[model samples]
Target: MAMEGESWPRVRAVLAEIFDRDAEDILPETLIMGDLGGESVDLLEIAVRLNADFGIPVDEDAAFLKSLRYLLAESREKGIEPEAALRAAYPHLSAERCATLAREAARPQAAPLLCAADIAAYAAAARK
Candidate 1:
């Protein structure tokens, strides 16, 4: 069964339940680690729930797992900061979204970059 529009709500609900919070409080942009009182253990639980609920493969070892800031810094270390690198790394995101992420990733004090939105996006992308 392919994930659909309902996936977002379901994803949010699953996170909410796993974290012992209300579903309404778990918005797409809510940071799982920083804002939701989630710990490292929560990451695995969330990934598991996402896979079981939406059939989305949440590879914790993916490049994006190190946070967008790490990705940007790592890319810069390689040479010639590429504009499409972000988009290429996260194929589920759009060009404009990639630009926004690149900017946010440059922030000095940015919080943990993984959010419910990422999980939702992964679910949507996995449907393809």
Candidate 2:
């Protein structure tokens, strides 16, 4: 579904849920490494959730993932729309309406790949 308001909140919500943390815990400026405490595997898991939820297949190849940040930066530089870039990468996500998605996200659903401290060893190690 197409997330409206151009709000990255949906992504944040997914991340927070997967991390077993409160939504307020993640600021827009937080880094996955320093602030959120994530690693390559955690990121891969996040990508997986993003794929499964949106029905977009994220190419995990280094060439693909590495170019992700670059694409965002390039999009910003070129004044191109973020959705355009997102669509370019993943065609399955429709331009879904915000009201529709709000209704969808509100329902009780299965959580993503979330783990507590003992289980999320990578997150724990990142704390050091």
TM-score of each: 0.82, 0.44
lDDT string, candidate 2, 80-120, tens digits: 76556644643323333222222332346522212221122
Best by TM-score: 1
Clashing pairs in 2: 2-96
- Tens digit of per-residue lDDT, candidate 1, span 49-95: 87787776787644134546656877788874644677767887657
Q: Provide C-alpha RMSD values for all models, in order.
A: 3.8, 14.1
Worst 10 residues of 1 by lDDT: 61-70
Best by lDDT: 1
Question: What's the CA error at residue 99 for candidate 1, in Å?
Answer: 1.8
How well does model 1 score by local distance difference test?
0.72
**CA-lDDT, candidates in order:** 0.72, 0.47
